[model samples]
Target: MTDAFVAALPKAELHVHLEGTLEPEMLFALAARNHVELPWPDVEQARAAYTFTGLEHFLPLLFRAASVLRTRQDFYDLARSYLTRAAADGVRRAEMFLGVQTFLDAGTPIGDQLDAVLAAISDARTDLGIDGALIVTSQRHRTQAAALEVLELIEPWRDRLLGIGLGAAERGNPPAKFADYYATARARGYRTTIHAGEDGPPEYVREALDICRADRIDHGVAASADPDLMARLGDEAVPLTVCPLSNVALRVVPSMAAHPLPAMMAAGLLVTVNSDDPPYLGGYVNDNYQAVHTDLGLDRPALADLARNSFRASFDDPHRIAAHLAAVDAHVRANQPPERAYRAASAAR
Candidate 1:
């Protein structure tokens, strides 16, 4: 499919991190605004440092950039910028993960951070017509008690939050570590998602399901390693927010062509394409869609399926989800060639 077609397709972004959306220019701007000194002297140098060998290599830089976000206004600008970009890329609904615990530990009040981010979401809904909500993600490397503390901390704004997520280095911090945390979040009526299988094993994905009872799995490409896991994901229709560019950028896979997304689709899994951390990872949602279409041989119809899957996998209301899915169908019908359109319509059946 053409890049234009992919960009025009209606979709939802379910796995973006607000901190990770910090563009180099904005990083420099925010750093300057907050009177913070960055190690990189220029934007080009900052961009150059985006290279990474793995998630461990990438996270330090991610958190370091976050250091510039010292005020409520800083968080507002970051969230607004990301929502604007997501809207431009035709994202109808976005569930963004904010590293609340990071800032909470930094001594920024939870109310200050949520106030700024929720304000951005409100403005995005009004200005861009792009609806979204925040997911307060806890760092996995930290202790489970710390995660539970975060859970308790977010109780005040539980109504504004879409869910809870576990992020960061996943190797040693298994999903089971957050089981009690997720249990408490669920008990309090918050949906749960866990970052599994990106830097961790397939067993971590299992724990994310069995132990944490995660409503969704982020970077769950590791599920492809176990045939049983693949079957279970397909049968259960557990949504996986797979970030193709992030996988390649972080060396989770050798390259985009080597990503297991195609295999996951073959196994009938409910997989949605996302930009985990676009600025650091190389591309946004549209870029991920374009990469798959070019490198993985996903045709126009297949790309549309990815878009539809995005809405289907979202935590948005059922009525909104149906409308977005219908919008995707209409977009495909209008954009694709007549023969391709007919084939796509048939394929949906």
Candidate 2:
């Protein structure tokens, strides 16, 4: 019953990476189509190689799979496939992050990437009935100058992009380094989100908020370590786009049972569950919802709240957000089993 409620609940996915969505099956197909040689000869072998010691270990492998995406159609197919899956998972709105700098560095034209993705988004909205937007993510491993260059290059498509984001290795690369880039993005009217605290320290989360002024913090699990930071996040009602399966896959947390999502919510922060890299991490949004429910012992109400939080944290328009929130409420109210409804009525009495 809980599973059915979650699968049909209206929700928004706010932290997925487009390049990271490249599945092994699609990876091999694109490799053959583009005449690129993959490190793994077969899909089974590629799937077997997904183990990672940490974020650093996983990035190189992600980049290798991304190499197969060389054409505009490659990106179109990638976005379309992921959007289809997201719709099935009950994602009403999706804000996907694409690391534009990597493709630029690889010599793929910016127009080819953006045009294909935007086209996919437009078609998906029409065909799948899932509204979608893109966040042109700049790789943190690169210099701030490079990030600025990317910001400028994307200016032509600014109206199409939902926002700008900082992603990739966050260890030595602090959020402070991209302050100017973020400031510039904001000056140009782009919503800014930063990846922090997944692998970096609590200080990184602080910098993201105090320095970058991030509209949302992605993977802010580390903020739990600092009482003041957690309190500030709560007081500010800052949104943390938390990814349970991705955290475990990257070893940010030992397992789903040990995830800090429950505590994050308990602290009053606006926390939303997402599948950061669905294919690479072994789950999508609904999978993350079920994992937290089973492993963390979150009840149906808690799961519903998480779904509501997702819609609230999204960058979609206000009317749409309200409508989606209403939909979530309706689904929860309609799906309650008799026993649970009786309990709620009894508690109210």
Candidate 3:
């Protein structure tokens, strides 16, 4: 059911991390290509090492995987790989997150990384027919001063870069800490989104919306816990990019059943399913769609609503978004219900 359901659905991806797209196979290949040494003995060992207990436990592995990305070609290759794979999963557009601070800290030339990634996105558009955009995400664990530096550096590529973003550990790095940075980005006419309520309290989500002025909220499932915030989000039509597999992988929720996606949707809040750090979490956007459908008991129309929300939440041009939304509706109208798809899949198995 899951496989067949996703094979026909197309959606936009908002919360995917380009650096997190580094599959173990590519990680080994890139490390060797750049003459860098990796801590893992083999690709299999690195793949086995993705068991993340929490954000702190997972960050080290994410950093280690990103270490191989020392050149522009490496970044370009990484983007190309992710886009091609995402396209196969019926993704027509992707707004990806890249933590440039990580590369700068490693002493790599920032232009080399940016130029490569931006070029790769251009290539994907022409070559793979997938529209892609970049959002330079600042490391939350770093100082807001450092985030301002990121804004300054990305100023030159203002036309190419989509917007400024905040990511990394959310425990101590509250959204309000970067209030000035978000204001700066908005003043410069760039869109913004922040990591909020993933591992933080609902107040963080509120701060992200009111203070940081996020154009959208990422992993805002925690917003469900606060009625006022939920009502506000629904009233404002704010979009929450939810990553179910990632939540389960990081133990953000006890299990998929415990995920508040259904409740959040019931609350009238706009929600879209995404695969955050797909390779690390053992799933992609399709895998996430499948899991939510099965675990949450969402049928085709419900799933179609998710697809509609994704395109609507995307940074696509309004006309393009309308076209994508129409495509989603057309597919949903043509496909069988999820239950029959599941029964067919079971028979094949």
Candidate 4:
């Protein structure tokens, strides 16, 4: 269908990274504001440097842009920009990922970081009427002890958080490495999800479910390779936050045409389309939805299914989720245009 129709559809974004939301303009502005030294001389140079072979190559770029965020307002401005953009894209709720270790390692005070993020969340709600929550994520490259330290830091700010998660490269650091970390978060009643099968095998998907007991799986597209794994994901109704553009941008698949979203849908997997890193990869939530609709040759009904799945897979409460889903269904009903009809008189003339 048309991009305008897709843009009007209500949805929720579940896989966005705050650091990944750093646009080139914001990067340079924040750098100048914070007086941070830079490797790139100008914004155009920084934007052109977004090219990458894979996630391994992208991590350094992510960190380099992230270096500009030093003070609490830096974090606040970063989050506020993302939330405002998300709101413009019809995102009713944005469950964003923030690896606090990035700021902590940069020597930004932990409390300052948390306070700034929370303030931005509150600002999004009050200013834009968009519900935003943070899922405090840990970098899997680090030790499990470090993961626990993040959990410990989040304890006081639990009211401000939606859950805890782990994400980074998936090859060497399996989801099982943070089993106890997940357990502690779970015990404290935090909803959990972990990255699996993005670059790892299907076995990592199983570990995330069985060991980590994750509420969802991020980029579990590799499950398409094994029928049994696909069946398990379908049967369990586990939500997979699939980022089509990000995957293609990172060469996870050859291109959007080769994405497994259609297969995952055929297998009855609860798949939600999201923008993992919008600014770096380009586009936001609605942009991702539109891209998949075109690349997969999906029609209105299929797009609606994906849009509804966004709310269904979200961490929002029952009333809000129900309202969003109903709104999506309503939009689908109203927007499905009719086909061309023949006019006998006009044809004769």
Give the Cα lDDT of each candidate. 0.92, 0.92, 0.90, 0.89
Summarize candidate 1's per-residue lDDT along 243-332 as a digit string, tens digits.
999999999999887899999998999999999999999799999999999999998889999998898998989999999999998897
Give the clashing pairs for model 3.
none
Can you write out model 2's per-residue Cα lDDT over 45-129, one digit (the tens) per residue?
A: 9999999999999999998889888989999999999999999889999999999877887889999999999999999999999
For model 3, what is the error of residue 161's alpha carbon versus the real structure, in angstroms, after optimal superposition? 1.3
TM-score of each: 0.97, 0.97, 0.95, 0.95
Q: lDDT tens digits, residues 1-349, model 3?
A: 4567676698999999999989999999998998889989998988889887988899988997798898878888999999999888889989999999999988877788789989988998998888999999999999999999988888878988888789999998899999999999999989999999999999999999889989999999888889999999999999889999999999999899999999998988889999999999858999999998888888778888999999989877999999999999778655867796687668889
Which order, best to worst by lDDT? 2, 1, 3, 4
List all candidate RMSDs to the true structure: 2.2, 1.8, 4.5, 4.1
Q: What is the lDDT of residue 254 in candidate 2?
A: 93
Candidate 1 clashes between residue pairs 3 or more apart in a chain or in different chains: none
Question: lDDT tens string, model 4, 1-349?
Answer: 3388788888899999998899989999999998998889998988888888999999988987898999999989999999998888888999999888988999998888878988999988999989999899999999999999998887888877899999887799998899999999999989998999998899999999999999999999999999999999999899999999999989889989999999999889999999999878757888788888887888778888988898889888999999999999778757755432234334557
Higher lDDT: candidate 2 or 4? 2
TM-score for model 3?
Answer: 0.95
